[model samples]
Target chain A: MTDAHEIRHEIRIATGDDIVRIRRAVRTVACAARMSLVDRTKLVTAASELARNVIGHGGGGTVRIERLISPSGVSGVRMVFEDAGPGIPDVRLALTDGWSTGQGLGLGLPGARRLVDEFDLQTVVGEGTRVTVTKWTR
Target chain B: MDRVPILKAGDVLLVSIQTDLEDRTVMALREDLAERIVRTGARGVVIDITAVEIVDSFIGQMLAGIAAMSQLLDARTVVVGMRPAVAITLVELGLSLGGVQTALDLETGLRLLGAGPLDGGPSEAQDRR
Candidate 1:
Protein backbone atom coordinates (compact mmCIF):
# COMPACT_ATOMS: atom_id res chain seq x y z
CA MET A 1 0.00 0.00 0.00
CA THR A 2 1.17 3.49 -0.70
CA ASP A 3 1.72 6.05 2.02
CA ALA A 4 -1.40 7.21 3.83
CA HIS A 5 -0.43 10.76 3.02
CA GLU A 6 -1.73 12.39 -0.14
CA ILE A 7 -1.86 15.94 -1.42
CA ARG A 8 -5.00 17.68 -0.27
CA HIS A 9 -6.34 20.89 -1.80
CA GLU A 10 -8.60 22.93 0.43
CA ILE A 11 -11.34 25.29 -0.68
CA ARG A 12 -13.55 27.40 1.55
CA ILE A 13 -17.22 27.16 0.71
CA ALA A 14 -18.42 30.56 1.84
CA THR A 15 -20.84 31.52 -0.93
CA GLY A 16 -22.44 30.34 -4.13
CA ASP A 17 -19.36 31.40 -6.08
CA ASP A 18 -17.28 29.01 -4.04
CA ILE A 19 -19.31 26.09 -5.34
CA VAL A 20 -18.11 26.88 -8.84
CA ARG A 21 -14.55 26.95 -7.55
CA ILE A 22 -15.03 23.57 -5.89
CA ARG A 23 -16.24 22.01 -9.12
CA ARG A 24 -13.32 23.45 -11.03
CA ALA A 25 -10.86 22.20 -8.44
CA VAL A 26 -12.35 18.71 -8.52
CA ARG A 27 -12.24 18.65 -12.30
CA THR A 28 -8.57 19.61 -12.35
CA VAL A 29 -7.66 16.84 -9.94
CA ALA A 30 -9.85 14.30 -11.76
CA CYS A 31 -8.20 15.16 -15.05
CA ALA A 32 -4.75 14.95 -13.49
CA ALA A 33 -5.66 11.48 -12.25
CA ARG A 34 -6.22 10.52 -15.89
CA MET A 35 -9.87 9.71 -15.35
CA SER A 36 -12.02 9.44 -18.45
CA LEU A 37 -14.34 12.24 -19.47
CA VAL A 38 -17.41 10.44 -18.17
CA ASP A 39 -15.78 9.79 -14.82
CA ARG A 40 -14.61 13.38 -14.63
CA THR A 41 -18.10 14.66 -15.25
CA LYS A 42 -19.55 12.33 -12.64
CA LEU A 43 -17.06 13.36 -10.01
CA VAL A 44 -17.47 17.03 -10.76
CA THR A 45 -21.25 16.76 -10.62
CA ALA A 46 -21.13 14.94 -7.32
CA ALA A 47 -18.81 17.54 -5.90
CA SER A 48 -21.14 20.27 -7.04
CA GLU A 49 -24.05 18.71 -5.18
CA LEU A 50 -22.10 18.29 -1.98
CA ALA A 51 -20.76 21.81 -2.14
CA ARG A 52 -24.22 23.18 -2.66
CA ASN A 53 -25.43 21.33 0.39
CA VAL A 54 -22.61 22.85 2.36
CA ILE A 55 -23.66 26.31 1.35
CA GLY A 56 -27.42 25.89 1.56
CA HIS A 57 -27.88 23.55 4.52
CA GLY A 58 -24.53 23.42 6.25
CA GLY A 59 -24.26 27.21 6.09
CA GLY A 60 -20.97 26.99 4.26
CA GLY A 61 -17.79 25.09 5.19
CA THR A 62 -14.67 23.70 3.60
CA VAL A 63 -14.07 21.18 0.83
CA ARG A 64 -10.87 19.18 0.57
CA ILE A 65 -9.81 17.49 -2.66
CA GLU A 66 -7.17 14.82 -2.46
CA ARG A 67 -5.39 12.41 -4.82
CA LEU A 68 -5.60 8.85 -3.56
CA ILE A 69 -3.50 5.85 -4.49
CA SER A 70 -4.75 2.43 -3.49
CA PRO A 71 -2.57 -0.55 -2.59
CA SER A 72 -2.95 -1.89 -6.10
CA GLY A 73 -1.54 1.36 -7.52
CA VAL A 74 -4.96 2.48 -8.70
CA SER A 75 -5.36 6.24 -8.50
CA GLY A 76 -8.53 8.12 -7.66
CA VAL A 77 -9.87 11.46 -6.45
CA ARG A 78 -11.37 11.99 -2.99
CA MET A 79 -13.50 14.92 -1.90
CA VAL A 80 -14.50 15.75 1.65
CA PHE A 81 -17.13 18.36 2.51
CA GLU A 82 -17.24 19.60 6.08
CA ASP A 83 -19.79 21.99 7.47
CA ALA A 84 -20.58 23.43 10.90
CA GLY A 85 -24.27 24.14 10.83
CA PRO A 86 -27.50 22.42 11.76
CA GLY A 87 -26.72 18.72 11.49
CA ILE A 88 -29.04 16.06 10.19
CA PRO A 89 -30.88 14.29 12.96
CA ASP A 90 -31.55 11.13 11.02
CA VAL A 91 -28.82 10.06 8.67
CA ARG A 92 -30.86 7.24 7.19
CA LEU A 93 -33.78 9.50 6.46
CA ALA A 94 -31.49 12.06 4.90
CA LEU A 95 -29.91 9.49 2.63
CA THR A 96 -33.23 8.19 1.42
CA ASP A 97 -34.24 9.32 -2.04
CA GLY A 98 -36.96 11.99 -2.18
CA TRP A 99 -36.37 12.93 1.46
CA SER A 100 -35.07 16.42 1.90
CA THR A 101 -35.25 18.85 4.78
CA GLY A 102 -34.35 21.74 2.56
CA GLN A 103 -35.96 23.12 -0.55
CA GLY A 104 -34.19 20.64 -2.80
CA LEU A 105 -35.12 17.60 -4.83
CA GLY A 106 -33.78 15.39 -1.99
CA LEU A 107 -31.31 13.90 -4.45
CA GLY A 108 -28.15 15.58 -3.17
CA LEU A 109 -26.89 12.91 -0.80
CA PRO A 110 -28.15 9.75 -2.47
CA GLY A 111 -27.45 11.07 -5.93
CA ALA A 112 -23.90 11.93 -4.92
CA ARG A 113 -23.49 8.43 -3.52
CA ARG A 114 -24.55 6.88 -6.80
CA LEU A 115 -22.01 8.92 -8.71
CA VAL A 116 -19.01 7.88 -6.64
CA ASP A 117 -17.43 4.52 -5.89
CA GLU A 118 -16.80 5.11 -2.17
CA PHE A 119 -19.14 7.09 0.07
CA ASP A 120 -18.92 7.93 3.76
CA LEU A 121 -21.03 10.20 5.95
CA GLN A 122 -20.48 11.38 9.52
CA THR A 123 -22.71 13.75 11.37
CA VAL A 124 -23.76 14.76 14.89
CA VAL A 125 -26.97 16.66 15.48
CA GLY A 126 -25.38 19.62 17.27
CA GLU A 127 -21.80 19.23 16.04
CA GLY A 128 -21.83 19.22 12.23
CA THR A 129 -21.60 16.97 9.14
CA ARG A 130 -18.88 15.62 6.94
CA VAL A 131 -19.29 13.74 3.68
CA THR A 132 -16.43 12.04 1.88
CA VAL A 133 -16.72 10.51 -1.57
CA THR A 134 -14.19 8.95 -3.91
CA LYS A 135 -14.18 8.04 -7.60
CA TRP A 136 -11.43 5.69 -8.71
CA THR A 137 -9.93 5.76 -12.14
CA ARG A 138 -10.87 2.77 -14.27
CA MET B 1 -22.91 39.42 -11.91
CA ASP B 2 -22.53 37.45 -15.13
CA ARG B 3 -25.86 36.96 -16.85
CA VAL B 4 -26.55 34.37 -19.54
CA PRO B 5 -27.26 35.96 -22.87
CA ILE B 6 -30.76 35.52 -24.22
CA LEU B 7 -30.99 35.77 -28.01
CA LYS B 8 -34.11 36.16 -30.07
CA ALA B 9 -34.41 34.31 -33.35
CA GLY B 10 -37.61 35.09 -35.20
CA ASP B 11 -40.36 34.00 -32.83
CA VAL B 12 -38.08 31.83 -30.69
CA LEU B 13 -35.89 32.73 -27.71
CA LEU B 14 -32.54 30.94 -27.53
CA VAL B 15 -30.57 30.75 -24.28
CA SER B 16 -27.20 29.06 -24.26
CA ILE B 17 -25.63 28.51 -20.86
CA GLN B 18 -21.93 28.57 -21.67
CA THR B 19 -20.41 29.21 -18.24
CA ASP B 20 -20.45 27.71 -14.81
CA LEU B 21 -23.64 28.85 -13.09
CA GLU B 22 -23.98 30.23 -9.59
CA ASP B 23 -27.17 30.04 -7.54
CA ARG B 24 -27.88 33.74 -7.84
CA THR B 25 -27.14 33.69 -11.55
CA VAL B 26 -29.67 30.92 -12.04
CA MET B 27 -32.30 32.91 -10.17
CA ALA B 28 -31.54 35.92 -12.30
CA LEU B 29 -31.80 33.77 -15.41
CA ARG B 30 -35.30 32.68 -14.44
CA GLU B 31 -36.39 36.29 -13.95
CA ASP B 32 -34.69 37.47 -17.13
CA LEU B 33 -36.18 34.66 -19.19
CA ALA B 34 -39.67 35.31 -17.89
CA GLU B 35 -39.34 38.96 -18.79
CA ARG B 36 -38.00 38.20 -22.28
CA ILE B 37 -40.84 35.80 -22.99
CA VAL B 38 -43.34 38.50 -22.10
CA ARG B 39 -41.60 41.22 -24.13
CA THR B 40 -40.91 39.13 -27.24
CA GLY B 41 -44.12 37.09 -27.11
CA ALA B 42 -42.02 34.13 -28.17
CA ARG B 43 -43.90 31.02 -29.17
CA GLY B 44 -40.93 28.71 -28.62
CA VAL B 45 -37.90 28.68 -26.32
CA VAL B 46 -34.79 26.66 -27.04
CA ILE B 47 -32.25 26.24 -24.25
CA ASP B 48 -28.88 25.00 -25.43
CA ILE B 49 -26.89 23.31 -22.68
CA THR B 50 -24.32 21.70 -24.93
CA ALA B 51 -21.57 23.79 -23.38
CA VAL B 52 -22.48 22.72 -19.87
CA GLU B 53 -20.73 19.55 -18.76
CA ILE B 54 -22.65 19.00 -15.55
CA VAL B 55 -26.29 19.22 -14.42
CA ASP B 56 -26.78 18.53 -10.74
CA SER B 57 -30.16 18.35 -9.06
CA PHE B 58 -30.21 22.12 -8.60
CA ILE B 59 -29.64 22.81 -12.28
CA GLY B 60 -32.06 20.07 -13.22
CA GLN B 61 -34.70 21.74 -11.06
CA MET B 62 -33.91 25.09 -12.62
CA LEU B 63 -34.42 23.68 -16.11
CA ALA B 64 -37.72 22.08 -15.13
CA GLY B 65 -38.88 25.32 -13.55
CA ILE B 66 -37.97 27.27 -16.67
CA ALA B 67 -39.87 24.83 -18.85
CA ALA B 68 -42.94 25.02 -16.67
CA MET B 69 -42.75 28.80 -16.66
CA SER B 70 -42.48 28.89 -20.44
CA GLN B 71 -45.46 26.58 -20.77
CA LEU B 72 -47.49 28.92 -18.58
CA LEU B 73 -46.41 31.79 -20.80
CA ASP B 74 -47.83 29.97 -23.86
CA ALA B 75 -44.39 29.10 -25.18
CA ARG B 76 -43.06 25.63 -25.90
CA THR B 77 -39.65 25.02 -24.32
CA VAL B 78 -37.19 22.56 -25.85
CA VAL B 79 -33.90 21.78 -24.09
CA VAL B 80 -31.21 20.65 -26.49
CA GLY B 81 -27.53 19.66 -26.66
CA MET B 82 -27.26 17.73 -23.42
CA ARG B 83 -23.92 16.02 -23.11
CA PRO B 84 -24.02 12.23 -22.77
CA ALA B 85 -22.40 12.32 -19.36
CA VAL B 86 -24.81 14.97 -18.15
CA ALA B 87 -27.80 12.91 -19.30
CA ILE B 88 -26.50 9.89 -17.47
CA THR B 89 -25.93 11.92 -14.33
CA LEU B 90 -29.44 13.40 -14.44
CA VAL B 91 -31.00 9.97 -14.79
CA GLU B 92 -28.87 8.62 -11.97
CA LEU B 93 -29.99 11.55 -9.83
CA GLY B 94 -33.58 10.34 -10.38
CA LEU B 95 -34.53 13.54 -12.12
CA SER B 96 -36.73 12.85 -15.14
CA LEU B 97 -36.94 16.55 -15.99
CA GLY B 98 -40.69 15.82 -15.74
CA GLY B 99 -42.35 18.16 -18.24
CA VAL B 100 -39.32 19.50 -20.06
CA GLN B 101 -39.04 18.63 -23.77
CA THR B 102 -35.59 17.55 -24.93
CA ALA B 103 -33.81 17.34 -28.29
CA LEU B 104 -30.38 16.29 -29.51
CA ASP B 105 -29.23 19.65 -30.84
CA LEU B 106 -30.28 23.22 -31.47
CA GLU B 107 -31.33 22.59 -35.08
CA THR B 108 -33.60 19.68 -34.20
CA GLY B 109 -35.10 21.61 -31.28
CA LEU B 110 -35.86 24.60 -33.46
CA ARG B 111 -37.25 22.42 -36.22
CA LEU B 112 -39.40 20.54 -33.74
CA LEU B 113 -40.71 23.79 -32.28
CA GLY B 114 -41.40 25.21 -35.74
CA ALA B 115 -43.08 22.19 -37.30
CA GLY B 116 -45.66 21.59 -34.62
CA PRO B 117 -48.62 23.77 -33.69
CA LEU B 118 -48.15 25.36 -30.32
CA ASP B 119 -49.82 23.03 -27.82
CA GLY B 120 -50.89 20.67 -30.60
CA GLY B 121 -48.67 17.64 -29.87
CA PRO B 122 -45.28 16.57 -28.49
CA SER B 123 -42.25 16.95 -30.73
CA GLU B 124 -41.09 13.83 -32.52
CA ALA B 125 -37.44 14.81 -32.30
CA GLN B 126 -35.24 12.13 -30.80
CA ASP B 127 -33.39 12.92 -27.56
CA ARG B 128 -29.84 11.82 -28.24
CA ARG B 129 -26.45 13.46 -28.10
Candidate 2:
Protein backbone atom coordinates (compact mmCIF):
# COMPACT_ATOMS: atom_id res chain seq x y z
CA MET A 1 0.00 0.00 0.00
CA THR A 2 1.81 3.10 -1.24
CA ASP A 3 -0.74 5.62 0.05
CA ALA A 4 1.24 8.83 -0.43
CA HIS A 5 -0.26 12.32 -0.65
CA GLU A 6 0.73 15.69 -2.11
CA ILE A 7 -1.38 18.80 -1.79
CA ARG A 8 -1.87 20.23 -5.24
CA HIS A 9 -4.27 23.11 -4.75
CA GLU A 10 -6.34 25.00 -2.19
CA ILE A 11 -9.32 26.96 -3.56
CA ARG A 12 -11.59 29.34 -1.69
CA ILE A 13 -15.29 29.15 -2.49
CA ALA A 14 -16.75 32.59 -1.99
CA THR A 15 -18.69 33.36 -5.17
CA GLY A 16 -19.81 31.75 -8.40
CA ASP A 17 -16.37 32.34 -9.83
CA ASP A 18 -14.75 30.09 -7.24
CA ILE A 19 -16.85 27.15 -8.35
CA VAL A 20 -15.50 27.49 -11.84
CA ARG A 21 -11.98 27.79 -10.46
CA ILE A 22 -12.28 24.62 -8.44
CA ARG A 23 -13.49 22.66 -11.45
CA ARG A 24 -10.52 23.84 -13.47
CA ALA A 25 -8.07 23.01 -10.70
CA VAL A 26 -9.43 19.50 -10.34
CA ARG A 27 -9.32 18.89 -14.07
CA THR A 28 -5.69 20.01 -14.24
CA VAL A 29 -4.57 17.54 -11.61
CA ALA A 30 -6.71 14.74 -12.98
CA CYS A 31 -5.21 15.19 -16.42
CA ALA A 32 -1.65 15.38 -15.11
CA ALA A 33 -2.22 12.11 -13.30
CA ARG A 34 -3.09 10.56 -16.69
CA MET A 35 -6.61 9.74 -15.62
CA SER A 36 -8.91 8.61 -18.41
CA LEU A 37 -11.18 11.15 -20.05
CA VAL A 38 -14.40 9.77 -18.53
CA ASP A 39 -12.86 9.49 -15.08
CA ARG A 40 -11.60 13.06 -15.33
CA THR A 41 -15.01 14.30 -16.38
CA LYS A 42 -16.76 12.47 -13.54
CA LEU A 43 -14.29 13.75 -10.96
CA VAL A 44 -14.53 17.31 -12.22
CA THR A 45 -18.32 17.20 -12.24
CA ALA A 46 -18.42 15.77 -8.73
CA ALA A 47 -16.15 18.56 -7.53
CA SER A 48 -18.32 21.16 -9.22
CA GLU A 49 -21.42 19.87 -7.48
CA LEU A 50 -19.68 19.84 -4.10
CA ALA A 51 -18.19 23.26 -4.60
CA ARG A 52 -21.58 24.75 -5.36
CA ASN A 53 -23.06 23.03 -2.33
CA VAL A 54 -20.35 24.59 -0.21
CA ILE A 55 -21.56 28.01 -1.24
CA GLY A 56 -25.28 27.51 -1.63
CA HIS A 57 -25.79 25.08 1.24
CA GLY A 58 -22.75 25.31 3.49
CA GLY A 59 -22.79 29.12 3.18
CA GLY A 60 -19.19 29.24 1.90
CA GLY A 61 -16.11 27.10 2.38
CA THR A 62 -12.82 25.92 0.88
CA VAL A 63 -11.68 22.90 -1.14
CA ARG A 64 -8.28 21.26 -1.13
CA ILE A 65 -7.01 18.97 -3.90
CA GLU A 66 -4.41 16.29 -3.34
CA ARG A 67 -2.53 13.80 -5.47
CA LEU A 68 -2.52 10.22 -4.28
CA ILE A 69 -0.80 6.93 -5.00
CA SER A 70 -3.09 4.04 -4.20
CA PRO A 71 -2.05 0.79 -2.64
CA SER A 72 -1.57 -0.92 -5.95
CA GLY A 73 0.51 1.91 -7.43
CA VAL A 74 -2.48 3.52 -9.08
CA SER A 75 -2.51 7.30 -9.37
CA GLY A 76 -5.52 9.22 -8.12
CA VAL A 77 -6.83 12.65 -7.15
CA ARG A 78 -8.70 13.55 -3.99
CA MET A 79 -10.55 16.67 -2.91
CA VAL A 80 -11.91 17.68 0.47
CA PHE A 81 -14.46 20.43 1.05
CA GLU A 82 -14.79 22.02 4.49
CA ASP A 83 -17.30 24.54 5.68
CA ALA A 84 -18.13 26.04 9.06
CA GLY A 85 -21.76 26.92 8.77
CA PRO A 86 -25.19 25.54 9.64
CA GLY A 87 -24.23 21.95 9.36
CA ILE A 88 -26.60 19.31 8.10
CA PRO A 89 -28.75 17.85 10.85
CA ASP A 90 -29.87 14.81 8.90
CA VAL A 91 -27.03 13.07 7.13
CA ARG A 92 -29.13 10.28 5.71
CA LEU A 93 -31.79 12.58 4.37
CA ALA A 94 -29.20 14.96 3.02
CA LEU A 95 -27.63 12.21 0.93
CA THR A 96 -30.93 10.90 -0.32
CA ASP A 97 -31.66 11.65 -3.97
CA GLY A 98 -34.33 14.23 -4.71
CA TRP A 99 -34.43 15.36 -1.07
CA SER A 100 -33.37 18.84 -0.05
CA THR A 101 -34.07 21.71 2.31
CA GLY A 102 -32.91 24.44 -0.05
CA GLN A 103 -33.84 25.65 -3.51
CA GLY A 104 -31.80 23.04 -5.31
CA LEU A 105 -32.35 19.91 -7.37
CA GLY A 106 -31.52 17.86 -4.24
CA LEU A 107 -29.03 15.82 -6.22
CA GLY A 108 -25.77 17.47 -5.21
CA LEU A 109 -24.73 15.19 -2.37
CA PRO A 110 -25.85 11.88 -3.83
CA GLY A 111 -24.84 12.83 -7.34
CA ALA A 112 -21.36 13.63 -6.16
CA ARG A 113 -21.09 10.30 -4.43
CA ARG A 114 -22.02 8.46 -7.62
CA LEU A 115 -19.32 10.16 -9.67
CA VAL A 116 -16.30 9.26 -7.58
CA ASP A 117 -14.50 6.10 -6.54
CA GLU A 118 -14.53 6.95 -2.84
CA PHE A 119 -16.83 9.20 -0.85
CA ASP A 120 -16.82 10.40 2.76
CA LEU A 121 -19.09 12.79 4.66
CA GLN A 122 -18.95 14.23 8.16
CA THR A 123 -21.23 16.87 9.58
CA VAL A 124 -22.45 18.12 12.94
CA VAL A 125 -25.76 19.84 13.45
CA GLY A 126 -24.24 23.02 14.90
CA GLU A 127 -20.62 22.76 13.79
CA GLY A 128 -19.73 22.21 10.14
CA THR A 129 -19.61 19.75 7.23
CA ARG A 130 -16.65 18.04 5.64
CA VAL A 131 -16.79 16.06 2.37
CA THR A 132 -14.02 14.02 0.85
CA VAL A 133 -14.14 12.35 -2.60
CA THR A 134 -11.47 10.53 -4.49
CA LYS A 135 -11.13 9.17 -8.05
CA TRP A 136 -8.42 6.80 -9.17
CA THR A 137 -7.05 6.25 -12.69
CA ARG A 138 -7.80 2.54 -12.51
CA MET B 1 -19.06 38.08 -14.91
CA ASP B 2 -18.14 36.87 -18.38
CA ARG B 3 -21.16 36.69 -20.61
CA VAL B 4 -21.71 34.04 -23.23
CA PRO B 5 -22.50 35.75 -26.50
CA ILE B 6 -25.89 35.23 -28.16
CA LEU B 7 -25.94 35.67 -31.92
CA LYS B 8 -29.05 36.15 -33.98
CA ALA B 9 -29.07 33.80 -36.94
CA GLY B 10 -32.15 34.44 -39.00
CA ASP B 11 -35.17 33.40 -36.93
CA VAL B 12 -33.00 31.47 -34.48
CA LEU B 13 -30.84 32.68 -31.63
CA LEU B 14 -27.51 30.81 -31.41
CA VAL B 15 -25.56 30.61 -28.20
CA SER B 16 -22.25 28.79 -27.88
CA ILE B 17 -21.02 28.03 -24.37
CA GLN B 18 -17.30 28.24 -25.05
CA THR B 19 -15.98 28.56 -21.51
CA ASP B 20 -16.48 27.46 -17.95
CA LEU B 21 -19.64 29.16 -16.73
CA GLU B 22 -20.21 30.67 -13.34
CA ASP B 23 -23.61 29.96 -11.84
CA ARG B 24 -24.49 33.65 -12.01
CA THR B 25 -23.49 33.79 -15.66
CA VAL B 26 -25.83 30.93 -16.45
CA MET B 27 -28.62 32.78 -14.72
CA ALA B 28 -27.80 35.92 -16.67
CA LEU B 29 -27.77 33.97 -19.90
CA ARG B 30 -31.27 32.77 -19.15
CA GLU B 31 -32.48 36.36 -18.87
CA ASP B 32 -30.47 37.49 -21.86
CA LEU B 33 -31.81 34.65 -24.00
CA ALA B 34 -35.38 35.37 -23.04
CA GLU B 35 -34.99 38.99 -24.00
CA ARG B 36 -33.37 38.07 -27.31
CA ILE B 37 -36.08 35.61 -28.23
CA VAL B 38 -38.74 38.18 -27.56
CA ARG B 39 -36.89 41.05 -29.22
CA THR B 40 -36.00 39.12 -32.34
CA GLY B 41 -39.25 37.17 -32.42
CA ALA B 42 -37.09 34.10 -32.89
CA ARG B 43 -38.80 30.85 -33.64
CA GLY B 44 -36.02 28.75 -32.18
CA VAL B 45 -32.84 28.78 -30.07
CA VAL B 46 -29.68 26.69 -30.42
CA ILE B 47 -27.31 26.26 -27.49
CA ASP B 48 -24.00 24.72 -28.46
CA ILE B 49 -22.04 23.24 -25.56
CA THR B 50 -19.35 21.29 -27.39
CA ALA B 51 -16.69 23.41 -25.74
CA VAL B 52 -18.07 23.24 -22.24
CA GLU B 53 -16.20 20.69 -20.14
CA ILE B 54 -18.93 19.83 -17.67
CA VAL B 55 -22.59 20.45 -16.84
CA ASP B 56 -23.29 20.10 -13.15
CA SER B 57 -26.78 20.04 -11.75
CA PHE B 58 -26.93 23.83 -11.65
CA ILE B 59 -25.93 24.18 -15.28
CA GLY B 60 -28.28 21.39 -16.20
CA GLN B 61 -31.03 23.41 -14.54
CA MET B 62 -29.93 26.41 -16.53
CA LEU B 63 -30.35 24.60 -19.83
CA ALA B 64 -33.73 23.28 -18.76
CA GLY B 65 -34.68 26.76 -17.58
CA ILE B 66 -33.72 28.34 -20.87
CA ALA B 67 -35.73 25.74 -22.76
CA ALA B 68 -38.79 26.22 -20.59
CA MET B 69 -38.54 29.97 -20.89
CA SER B 70 -38.22 29.74 -24.65
CA GLN B 71 -41.17 27.41 -24.90
CA LEU B 72 -43.38 29.97 -23.24
CA LEU B 73 -41.98 32.63 -25.56
CA ASP B 74 -43.14 30.53 -28.53
CA ALA B 75 -39.60 29.50 -29.35
CA ARG B 76 -37.97 26.09 -29.49
CA THR B 77 -34.62 25.42 -27.74
CA VAL B 78 -32.11 22.80 -28.86
CA VAL B 79 -28.81 21.99 -27.10
CA VAL B 80 -26.08 20.53 -29.24
CA GLY B 81 -22.55 19.06 -29.25
CA MET B 82 -22.35 17.87 -25.66
CA ARG B 83 -19.18 15.87 -25.07
CA PRO B 84 -19.65 12.13 -24.54
CA ALA B 85 -17.99 12.32 -21.15
CA VAL B 86 -20.24 15.15 -20.07
CA ALA B 87 -23.29 13.21 -21.23
CA ILE B 88 -22.34 10.16 -19.18
CA THR B 89 -21.57 12.28 -16.18
CA LEU B 90 -24.90 14.03 -16.42
CA VAL B 91 -26.75 10.72 -16.55
CA GLU B 92 -24.85 9.44 -13.53
CA LEU B 93 -25.55 12.73 -11.78
CA GLY B 94 -29.25 11.83 -12.14
CA LEU B 95 -30.24 14.76 -14.34
CA SER B 96 -32.37 13.41 -17.15
CA LEU B 97 -32.75 16.89 -18.67
CA GLY B 98 -36.16 15.68 -19.75
CA GLY B 99 -37.32 19.15 -20.78
CA VAL B 100 -34.38 20.01 -22.98
CA GLN B 101 -34.08 18.90 -26.62
CA THR B 102 -30.60 18.00 -27.78
CA ALA B 103 -28.71 17.15 -30.98
CA LEU B 104 -25.33 15.67 -31.72
CA ASP B 105 -24.01 18.78 -33.44
CA LEU B 106 -24.85 22.35 -34.36
CA GLU B 107 -26.04 21.41 -37.81
CA THR B 108 -28.53 18.93 -36.47
CA GLY B 109 -29.73 21.41 -33.88
CA LEU B 110 -30.41 24.03 -36.48
CA ARG B 111 -32.38 21.54 -38.48
CA LEU B 112 -34.47 20.63 -35.44
CA LEU B 113 -35.41 24.29 -35.04
CA GLY B 114 -36.22 24.44 -38.78
CA ALA B 115 -33.60 26.61 -40.34
CA GLY B 116 -34.74 29.87 -41.83
CA PRO B 117 -32.19 31.84 -43.83
CA LEU B 118 -29.25 30.30 -41.95
CA ASP B 119 -27.78 28.56 -45.01
CA GLY B 120 -24.48 27.65 -43.40
CA GLY B 121 -24.21 24.12 -42.02
CA PRO B 122 -21.40 22.48 -40.04
CA SER B 123 -19.12 25.28 -41.22
CA GLU B 124 -20.86 27.66 -38.88
CA ALA B 125 -19.89 25.50 -35.93
CA GLN B 126 -16.43 24.91 -37.34
CA ASP B 127 -15.88 28.62 -37.87
CA ARG B 128 -16.42 29.23 -34.19
CA ARG B 129 -13.73 26.71 -33.34
Worst 10 residues of 2 chain A by lDDT: A1-10
| Candidate 2 lDDT score at position B122 | 53
Over 4 Å off, model 2:
A1-3, B120-129
Q: Which candidate is the best by lDDT?
A: 2
**What are the per-residue Cα lDDT tens digits for candidate 2 across B1-129?**
789899987899999998898888899999999999889999999999999989999999989999999999999999999999999999999999999999998887988887832555455556688
Residue pairs in candidate 1 whose N, alpha carbon or C atoms collide under 3 angstroms: none
Residue B31 CA displacement from its true place in model 1, Å: 0.8
**Can you write out model 2's per-residue Cα lDDT over A1-138, one digit (the tens) per residue?**
433655489999988889888998998989877899999999999999999899988889999998888777889899999999899988999999999888889999999999998999999977899999989887
Q: What's the TM-score of each model vs. the native? A: 0.92, 0.93
- The lDDT of model 1 is 0.89
Docking class of 1: medium
